[model samples]
Target chain A: MAKQFDQRKETEYSSRDLETGCVITDPGNAARYKTGDWRSQRPTWNTLRCIKCGLCSLYCPEGCIAPNAEGYYEADLYYCKGCGICSRECWTQAITMIEEEE
Target chain B: MMTGKRIGMESSLGIAEAVKLANADVVAAYPITPQTHIVERLAELVANGELDAAYIPVESEHSAMSACLGSAATGARTFTATAGQGLELMHEVLYVASSMRLPIVMAVANRALSSPLNVWGDHSDVMAVRDTGWIQMFAENGQQVFDLTLCAFRIAEDPEVLFPVMVHLDGFHLSHVVEPFYLMEQDVVDKFLPRFRFPLALDPDKPLTAGAFFPPGVYGEARRAQDDALRSVRPVISRTWREFEEISGRSYKPVETYRADDARVLLLTMGSFSETAMLAIDQLRERGQQVGLVRIRLWRPFPFTEFRQAVGNAETLVVLDRAISYGGPTGPVCAEVKAALYSEPKRPRIVSYVGGLGGRDILVSEFVEMIEKGTALAESGVEEELLTIGVRV
Candidate 1:
């Protein structure tokens, strides 16, 4: 039906892997333990705007988000289905699911 | 040999007979062109209480597939049927049924795609969802359709297989065609298809979550489990087929080759078109053409080994695809078959074709035309005809 195509989101926020600085392979539900793929559509945070509340990590039902070596929150989006619970639950404008086109 | 009697009936009725005999717990489906009769009779049986099962009336094919998944997950045996746009609409959930490891069965009345809008028999409906992770089978006659529908449940519910099955039949041609068949008494079918059991199930006392979200760390295991399940089911499928033969006096295999034992050319097809090709093969043989036909009865978990053995030795391979791939050189089946053979050192000379678009006719005469076109191309060594056959108007 036209309704299915009508709900399409053209823009997706692209996230870069902090370790490799490469794009994530699977922004949502990517394979485990693989080379970084620019194809991943993950969300990157501006840590300065983050308050260390850990809301994003807690809200991620997929548990893809965890603390980095620096104790800063990070998301492992390979298993993320882009449910958008993370961005919606964020108190600060720090967490956002950006579209690629945007 | 166990003696049995056959009675003539429409193929859809035969399927309904088999479904009743299978003693499935749930039959849920949305009606679509060419496949309505199957679910209609099924609903009637449930209404009359002649059969003890829940016949779910669904709004759309999507919901129908979802209901089957729901019933199947609860450890209830479930089945559904659809065609053309209905199959396409259920495309998203088709993979879900397989991935969730529910052994649901579906009868797909093969039909055409839209734009011009025609409702007849073709492979376009099933072809679109070929990679949906379900086990797929194609049946030629009303008899095979009945035989394979039973075989579908056995294969799908086998602890090893734990995969959904799609028993595909040509819309109208087979779905509505009348033929002779022997209906299995409920007792025999009960012995043949046992109640489904799943090691993993949602129980109120020992609750378990399904379709849980997994991160990258855990996703691999689920997929690996699925792949391994498919591989492990090979032996189970064979055993089930043997058991079915013993119980119902019928047998089945992954790939069925006709008159190919002594031949140079092979005609490969899936669905009712194979029947047309069978007729053509007979005519071709009479005319001194060493032509044989290979029908891919089982498409998914494709009989790669059987396919190799059947077409591997042919001097010329002409694969007739009843659906178009748009930009591809071959239909979905031919492309996969070619990929499977590319690794072999002594592959047969192969030519691809795209025919019978929009459920247009793939007549026996057209198959004769396709073979002639293929032989000429083989002589000149061309890649393919790209697309041909079927009616222009």
Candidate 2:
């Protein structure tokens, strides 16, 4: 790990202060690390059955579900981990868990 | 001239007063033997409306330290106290507290770790957390405890060195013992330690994360950065000590030496046992034994320069450690001394002894005996790495 990104030399310490560790210089960088690749099972929201109650969004473990322009809820695959939690938690049975094909 | 109020008080109360005077914003703690008095007093102060702060009676030491991390992240001046098992329970969080650069002040009433459930004085607890990257210090008495606790905040909160600081006092030996000491007035303490201003607070307006997870790509650099910060805190510690001396008329040094000039033999100690070792040195000097004493006041950042100078040209250096390192070189302090003086041009032969475990009393006479034994061994040139003294066979 040190062989990479350790551009600073030891001599630099004499004139410079240490880079404070893991301090969030940029806000909300968690969005950059895409966890969608980890999905084996993904949740598909049935927009007609969603009822626009937002229960699927509320129950999403990864918080990847959001409302579409038509006031219906949909799953954002970018941040979803395919937890199936929203599918199980949907009282209206508006979400369905589907296996992702290799 | 003694500044402010001069009164007799226990070491625990003295530290509590120092924290109160520093005006800590949040105190989260769980009661443990030897360390209870400090937090209890703080709790009382909070309950009585004397100190306007949040007093959290956490479920456990882990929760206590976790709460401190949360409170400190919000730019609050956080304080906590723990000992022995309590410290062990909170062990994991110790790393988080320092790595996050939360400037929290922790008072550790040093105690023996329990298998036998011993709650007395020893260095086992503090030694365990040595690698946590916190600025560590040891106090010999009530006055030192009071003064150092205040200095801890200033040193930890310094913008150049935003690290946690742990002030360790021997459990029961210092904490329970009452002694006369000078207490600085609230105004004086205020002047000495300014209100801690943390640049990165968990504010709603300026949203930022404190302890973000590091990937393997940058983990090593992150650690190097933390270590660099730790190693560079000496100047800040010195400046804080100097400022404190000016305010309180009390002098403090990283490694304090006593009557060691022109001595053939030197004895090294830390925490309260250093006082007993001093008495032993005085007696040895009266008999012309040519012996001296060295007490380590600042534990972490190891004070290598001061320690080497303190040991000087002594032919024999005897280190008395309160905690054993089990099967290692001898004791924790002895191993550190040998490592620190390894490449010195004229280093003294170190004789390591582990005694005073589980609150066992290490009398002045015992210190004298250890020095004599070490001197004899040094003359013989026999390599005895570590020895346990005064233990029942």
Clashing pairs in 2: none
Calculate the i-RMS of every candidate, to one decimal place: 13.9, 5.4
Which stretches in model 2 have alpha-carbon errors above 4 Å? A1-21, A37-60, A63-102
TM-score per candidate: 0.79, 0.88
Report lDDT (Cα) of residue B86, candidate 2: 97
RMSD of 1: 9.8
CA-based DockQ, model 2 = 0.30
Give the top-scoring candidate (DockQ).
Answer: 2
Instruction: Report the lDDT tens digits of candidate 1 across residue range B132-238.
Output: 88888898899889888988888887776788999999998888889778767677777777776765555666554466554454355456656655656666777
Candidate 2, residues A21-64, lDDT tens digits: the string is 45665566666776897999888877677778887888887888
**lDDT against the true structure, each candidate:** 0.78, 0.87
